[model samples]
Target: MTLDELRATAAARHDTCAQIKKMIVSRLDLPIEPAWITDDQPLFGRGLELDSLDVLELYVAIEAEFGVALYDSDMSVFGSVSRLADHVNPALAERAPTGSA
Candidate 1:
């Protein structure tokens, strides 16, 4: 791909990650800014401190917002914002950043 094409792809991935962060914060009513969440930040356990309930909420929110059903997906899909981005927006999978999950 050309330089502009590469940049566009990166931008799209960044946008998708940002959207996921916003959705997480809004859906969960977190007290932090969406930009504060890094693309590779973990979504559960000691990372975001999310629990199983939060996962259910995220499942609904993801479907309503992205029209993607993640109910049958495993926990790895929620490994990180960038990882989630890949599932919600499959076009990014080919160029997904390292350590996303």
Candidate 2:
């Protein structure tokens, strides 16, 4: 791809990550602002300090907000903001109305 196309892709990815951060903060009633959450920061443990109950809440919120069902048994997607964004954005794209993309 051309440099312009690459930049566009990166911009879109950044926008999606920002949107995901906002969604997480809003849905979880986080004390921190969305902009404060870096994309690579761990979602649980030492990073955001989230717990199992928070994970459950996140699952529900993600399903309701993004129309993506998250299984609690699968923790791979919860590793970081970027991971969640990677998982959710495609689901969002798929749920978009036909011909929207």
Candidate 3:
């Protein structure tokens, strides 16, 4: 890919990360800014300390916001924001209209 293509891909990933963080905070009612979520920080346990119910809520929110249907086998990607983005970006790309950057 050209440098421009690489830049575009990076920008799209960044946007998706921000959107996911916002959805997490809003759907979970967390008192945190989207920017406060680091890409590699865990979303559960000692990190954000979310529980199973929170994960369920987040799943619902993700489906509603991104039109992606995640399955039980896909749960491993929820470990961190970056991992979530990696799982989600392809689905988002599929949903994006042709020629949109």
Candidate 1 vs candidate 3: the TM-score winner is: 1
User: Which scores better on TM-score, 1 or 2?
Assistant: 1
**What TM-score quantifies how close candidate 1 is to the native fold?**
0.91
Off by over 4 Å in 1: 97-101
**RMSD in order of candidates:** 2.2, 6.9, 6.7
lDDT of 3 by residue, 1-101 (tens): 89998788778878888989999988988898989998767988888888989988887888889877675735566878867876667754454442322
Instruction: List the global CA lDDT of all models.
Output: 0.92, 0.79, 0.78
> Cα miss at 30, model 1 (Å)?
0.5
Q: The CA-based lDDT of model 3 is what?
A: 0.78
Report clashes for each candidate as comma-separated counts: 0, 0, 0
Scored by lDDT, model 1 comes in at: 0.92
How much is 55 displaced in model 1, in angstroms?
Answer: 0.3
| Residue lDDT tens for model 2, 5-27 | 87877777688789888988987
- At residue 2, give the lDDT of candidate 1: 100
List candidate 2 stretches off by more than 4 Å. Answer: 91-101
Model 2 worst lDDT run, 10 consecutive residues: 92-101
- Between candidates 2 and 3, the TM-score winner: 2
> How many steric clashes does model 3 contain?
0
